[model samples]
Target: MVAPPDNDVLRASALHFQHHDGSPALQGVSLGVREGEVLAVTGPRGSGKTSLLRCLAGLDRPQRGEVWFDGVAVHTLGALARARLRRHRFGWIDPVPVLVPELTVWENAALPLMLRGTGRRRARRAALEWLERLDVDGRARSRPHELRHSERQRVCIARALTVVPSVLFADEPTAPLHRAESAQVLRTLTAAARSHGVTVVLACAGPRRAGLADRTVTLLDGRRVRTLHLPPVAGPAGPAEGAEPAGSAGTEGRPACSLSA
Candidate 1:
């Protein structure tokens, strides 16, 4: 297989996937994410946004197509190798925050670092730093069950950021949040990513959410229909004309984020 360019952090070519019941999800989809760029995948429900994100992140393999990451063919990696890649090179945030019930919020956030063999004291310090960045530091000692949905999501973001993964895959990360909370979380996410030069592939169900991305790829009926490149400076004019509204972007009802890592 031909390799992607050196500047491309992740590349997907002619991807196709089907559901367990034999329903089509992604059909001949292809895209590339540049280093440190935030690319948003948007489409109406069942438009294959989640499936596409999964394939790119190596959480799910497509029946046809190739996924290249950092010069490696991700689709060809064994399960264990893929898992290691995810743990070491990628960060992920889901629509719903899934934390370890027994662990405190900080502990949950530190889990990734701990798994990587970082010392508990150092991991806790790093996790707290991220929690503060996400504005969830006050809840550090609290358990996931004790926090609100938004707070839980913030902690999840903190967890993902603690490792400072090279690429972050966020799927409907703000679905459970209010408009203001969503904006705040997105701001934190994007800001941290920019500062760290983390490439982000965010699957957003709403146009408002996609507004935060540098560019958006729209899918229809499991196929990529169009790609919209947003201006570097967003003005008051609001979503460029012809941009697809969130309503038109199909939601596949799949789990918001990848749990593989």
Candidate 2:
């Protein structure tokens, strides 16, 4: 497992990336995830959620503004530099999902480490350990086609984390799973990340699979709409000693701003 970062592993300020028609895909999105923090990005399809995650992972460079990871300005780096950073520090789970159907579960999970210079035998061994932690070790030699869809997804995740990245960028990390399995996956992800002090920026739609994150934020028409409302802290005077304490003044997960489309 990777050690905790002494500082922020991922931070971005006012990032703007556009689509082919000159339409904005993401606009003025600013958010920060500290090491060991899990933040969920939720929005409708094309609400800039995937784009935002891609920009942060350096898969797609933003047209304007900058993205920084672990104090390194990713937007300023060249292709090779970005790739190196991604390999060493970032684990990006694709939105559509990708896995080699011919490779066994162990091979698929260990491929990342092998590509990073771990010998195949050693990679396979370490990969089995990851599968054990994810509770799928019994499927070690099973190929992708032999497993169920949810199992494949979890294997892909294990592959992503095989290298113990400092920051994991998970786009649609949870998909097509029953509630029980989804919660199990989320529990595993956060617990594993916290142990290694890895920050997880997972993008998904819906209520975020029950017990998934410490905070959740929304994106609308290409910008972050503060989706968390913290209550006014109690005054030292103790809210004038009585008062109903404001009933609905402090709901938890509503957006601070709204966008027209």
Candidate 3:
């Protein structure tokens, strides 16, 4: 097996995976994430962003290829070993907010630490700190069902951050929030990760949402692509018509290339 770069904390090479029903999810996709870097994986729906993150996070094993973390072969690890790694070294945020209905907000946020054998008081302290940073501390005593959708999502973000994981996998983390709320949460998440020297792998559907990352890699049809943003051109109409490229584009200050699906 080939070794990943010395700088890459996580790496996937020529991965291939399919759903149980035989639907392709990732096709020969390969990428590397550097230590403490926020890497955004952007693509349209059904383009395999979630699948790629899942494979890298060890939530699912690819049918082919390999995943590596800190020079260890993640793809070769047993299911229980992967679970232990995730609980201790990684954090995850899904598109939707998921919390225990019976647990208070702070309790939910502290759950990971408690599960890992931390003292309840210490875990609660850490969880409350994160919730305050995410602007959700006021809801600490409330239940999940008592908060708005956006509030609940913020709690989820806080929960993920309380662990200060080595690599945080956020799959459309701001999906449930309004544009304003999304920006705030992203800023907090990215800033916290940076301050703590955490590597982040964030997945989003488009470029606008991926701007905070230091670098970005896009996927299309379960494969890597070089997407270009062509300026909109005026069409055959007076001042009101324009044409934009049909393909997606990378954010400014990063690599750019023509879209090739």
Each model's TM-score?
Answer: 0.86, 0.82, 0.89
Give the Cα error of residue 132 in candidate 2, in Å.
1.9
Residues 132-236 of candidate 2: C-alpha lDDT, one tens digit per residue: 887778999888888888888888788888888888988877675677887888788778888887788988776545247878777766877654232233678
Candidate 3 residue pairs that clash: none
| Cα error of candidate 2 at position 260, Å | 14
* TM-score (C-alpha) between model 2 and the true structure: 0.82
Question: What digit string (tens of lDDT, one per residue) describes model 3 on residues 1-261?
Answer: 667656899999899999999999999998999999999999877889999999999999999999999978999999999999999999999999999999999999999999999999999999999999999999999999999999999999999999999999999999999998898899999999999999999999889888899998988778887764433434576223443334554533222334443
Candidate 1 vs. true structure, TM-score: 0.86
A best-first ranking of the candidates according to their lDDT comes to 3, 1, 2
After superposition, candidate 1 runs with Cα above 4 Å error: 227-261
- Candidates in order have lDDT scores of 0.85, 0.77, 0.90
Error of 3 at 33 (Å): 0.4
Q: Given candidate 2, what's the lDDT at residue 87?
A: 85
lDDT of 2 at 158: 84
lDDT digits (tens) for residues 1-261 of candidate 1 = 668766788998899999889999988888889999999888666778888988888999899999999999999998999999999999988889999999999999999999999999999999999999999999999989999988999999999999999999999988888999889889989989999999999998767788888988887677776443222233497545544333332333232321110
**Which candidate wins on TM-score?**
3
